[model samples]
Target: MAYVIDGDKCDAKITWLPVSGSLKTGELVELIQLVEEDDKLSREALALKDIFNDIIEEGLTYPQLGYHDESRFKSYYLSHAAFALRLANSGKVIGGFYIKPNFPGRCSHICNAGFIVDMAWRGKGAGRFMAEQYKLLAPELGYRASMFNLVFVSNQGSIHLWESLGFKKIGVVPQAGNLKGIGYQDALQFYFSFVKE
Candidate 1:
């Protein structure tokens, strides 16, 4: 995948190898910022609110799973996720994503991913650019298939994009999402096989 890197802003390129402590700190901050902004998108509002309340805010308050700690961030990428960052033309973080093996043992061939574009940069094609980049990186990351576990049904824009990229809705979980005024709604599962030719 071709990445537009801001040399002054991002000091590192996309690499699976872990970074030094200070650089890792930079990455986490950027990733969190992306997720925070993503929380406001119509498609992500509900799920992000739930996560913010149940995990980020609540768990941190109770010291459950060290939610407030940075080590948890490091450990997540090291153990379960292959995280990446995309810097803006100005060198600030514009987007980031994590692609991971969906399951253990026999199911390890499937990959799952989560991505977000900076709220300030949304609708400018950042999300699309990041996704296109991920498609090229998937095989190198060792994934033969890619799946999105919980796409909000209302996120038709994203649905169209993913469909254009060859993903298909394989199933839906009814009333699985709590949309503010709408109460609850179904969530769609999308999948794509990326087996290299």
Candidate 2:
């Protein structure tokens, strides 16, 4: 399945929902549970849950998860420009993406984004669908380019998906990712500059 963005196409019954507010804490907790407990998901997610949970739960504030990494919860990444993917037939959040400034001030025009597909939906095209939607949505959000800063080298499916969507491999940092099955491997950086239509 794919998201209809200009020329991009997908046959799945799905819709892209614009992110309105932060994920509710209850929903976030459930999401964290899913990420942590789901054995079918990519091992990278399971391993990072140790660090990822802290980042998210700390921002769960109004309640503090204490000593959590707040670095990943940047206001830009949680902005309304983000998107939630759901079934067109039924509003189930199968996946989503967040958009944020890749750098401050001078380089803010170039954005950064991340996508996560729910465990139940991983093999069902949710990831690619979100990517296509993001490309179309990025320009509307005032970004001229988008970058994925740390795509793990072992995630071949994602690497291929991004490349298919017009993102280019800009560079790689050797042994930056310690994925579960793949162990320590190169981490790749991808960049895509949108052409105004």
Best candidate (score: lDDT): 2
TM-score of model 1 vs. true structure? 0.61
Error of 1 at 71 (Å): 4.0
For model 2 the local lDDT of residue 169 reads 99
Clashing pairs in 1: 9-91
Per-residue alpha-carbon lDDT of candidate 1 for residues 78-134, written as tens digits (9 for 90 to 100): 233333334422345444566666665567667777665455545666556557666
Tens-digit lDDT string for candidate 2 (58-98) = 33101123342323332222332444555543455556556
Task: Score residue 171 of candidate 2 by CA lDDT.
Answer: 96
Candidate 1 segments whose C-alpha is farther than 4 A from its true place: 1-69, 75-85
Candidate 2, poorest ten consecutive residues by summed lDDT: 4-13
TM-score for each predicted model, relative to the true structure = 0.61, 0.61
- Candidate 2 lDDT score at position 195: 66
